[model samples]
Target chain A: MAGVDMDMQILIVDDYKTMLRIIRNLLKQLGFNNVDEATDGAQALQKLRDKPYQLVISDWNMEPMSGLQLLKEVRTDTKLKDLPFVMITAESKSENVVAAKQAGVTNYIVKPFNAATLKNKLQAVLGAF
Target chain B: MTDQAETNGHEQRLEALVSRYKDIDPDDLVNIVEGIINTAQGDLSSVNLKVYGEIEALSRYIHSARQEIASLRPDEITDEHIPAAGEELEAIVGATEQATNSIMESVEAIEKEAETLPPEVAQRLTDSVTQVYEACGFQDITGQRITKVIHCLTHIEEKVNALLETFGEPGERSARERKANETSGAADAELMNGPQSSEDAISQDDIDALLASFD
Candidate 1:
């Protein structure tokens, strides 16, 4: 809130409803009140194409489409390519990190993460909010 | 009645038939002796026919048994049962998600209320609430684990359904499974397996180091 635009439009995508709520609540706690939600990559992609979002926080495993796929699509799009995207998922394999990095992820947050860890990941991309 | 093959293979059987019955009406001969007396052969033909019938019946029974075991639910297991198991796991995921949301809702209310309390009490309450938020993460991890299980169940269902097709009539499940197998939408998606336990998987520190390398 002090150093960042607390009103910046952010989109959080995950297939799990609870995870969505958790992320929304966490983002709210961090003073980023303007947030959107998508349940999977296809819906998230559609949302991204339709509007401008400051950041994308997505889970890696989802039906029909995964976060990595969504990131790849975003990176390839001229309009959305530079949008900051962070992947927050239970996937912690080394290759998963490598793949997300290759696809232009802003940061990776493994699952079972606490508020501190989430804040750190966010601050890294969003500039120390 | 027709001249036998008289081939070297069946010659012995043909000789017995010819000598015993000759021109006799086999039916009449059987009636005189007993019902199965080959009726026609008046000798081993009835016994041979009975043995052949028994063997045929046994073969049919064995095939039916194989169908029962392999098909599991016989008619519906392939189409329904395995999917049902996977559905049950999905339901569990749903139930856990519901419970997790309920708990988070309460935590949200608590966090909201913390603002009204005395500063020290509010800060303590907020800290405890943050812990609750962290604890809520179990829902995500467990949900992922359950999803992996559901995937496994679906895989097994596919395999079982394939075996079912071999033993029984091919049906809708088989066709659907074949279609799914043929579709390679994400050829290497399998390599990006979901998270492993902390001990088995890379840590945040490791990821940070990797990200630095990319930078």
Candidate 2:
């Protein structure tokens, strides 16, 4: 896999603590050691602004600011606009995909994905991994 | 003899009139009877009209209350949300099971290979594998929590449906209709399907095709 360096900084955002833990474990399995977490989109956006991350994986449903809203914010910000963003949601609707695409998401993954799916999605966004 | 008989008859007639005069005050009795009848008629009509009006108002209030309760079908909390959450939980369980199995298989494979390795290295690998096994126990706890959540949601749905049946308006949407009308949001009407059944949701291939079309 030639996609992302294992040492690259990654930000994962989800409202559910279990989900966060699950994703963190999956990333660990994938050998991605440098990872941070935010409980909601607002906190995620704050983290994005404060730090430099190679990737952002966010859940769609969250309080205060949803993943879509956060995507829009990331796309609009001058410094963060180029950051590769992936939306991880249980929502499988075509409209959601289109909206995320329109908002400039790097990729999309439905929830309950395994290490392989995450790896493939990361590869698609970053390079051949 | 004829004069005595005439006197006896007149005296009997006078006695009969005087007997009728017992329980005196005929004028007052006439007034009492008239008053009772008049009051009964007047009061009954007035009271009956007032009661009828009150009943009409109560009916209207009930109708309004029913309409309000029917409208309380929340936008956020849908019957779909519960099932979607369940599906997610199921997926998690399946994934965890698969991972656990894979880890066990790997450990067994490693055990066969470990015979060539030194004692300390073999022990370390075994301990690491054991930790992986321990971590997989999270699935059991998560599954229990998800089951509890599903039960609570099911209970809520039953109560809501019952309330709707008892108080909802006739033309209000059925569960089917409400589901059909459910939109994800204005921004992503097409993409708002949370979790779909096998039939309704498109596959990853379909998503790829859709994305390809946009290009």
DockQ of candidate 2 is 0.16
Q: What is each candidate's fraction of native interface contacts (fnat)?
A: 0.65, 0.21
Q: lDDT for each of the candidates?
A: 0.80, 0.69
Error of 2 at A127 (Å): 0.8
lDDT tens per residue, model 1, A66-116: 788889999999999999999998888888888889889999988878889
Writing each residue's lDDT as its tens digit, candidate 2 over B74-123 gives: 43244566557657777876776566656656755675576578989976
Off by over 4 Å in 2: A1-3, B1-193
Candidate 2, A1-129: lDDT as tens digits: 564587889999986655666677667656788999998788999999999999999987665667888899999999999999998776666777788888988888865455567778887788874
The local distance difference test score of model 1 is: 0.80
User: Which candidate leads in DockQ?
Assistant: 1
What's the i-RMS for candidate 1 in angstroms?
Answer: 2.1
Interface RMSD of 2: 6.7
TM-score of every candidate: 0.74, 0.53
| C-alpha lDDT (0 to 100) for residue B144 of candidate 2 | 41
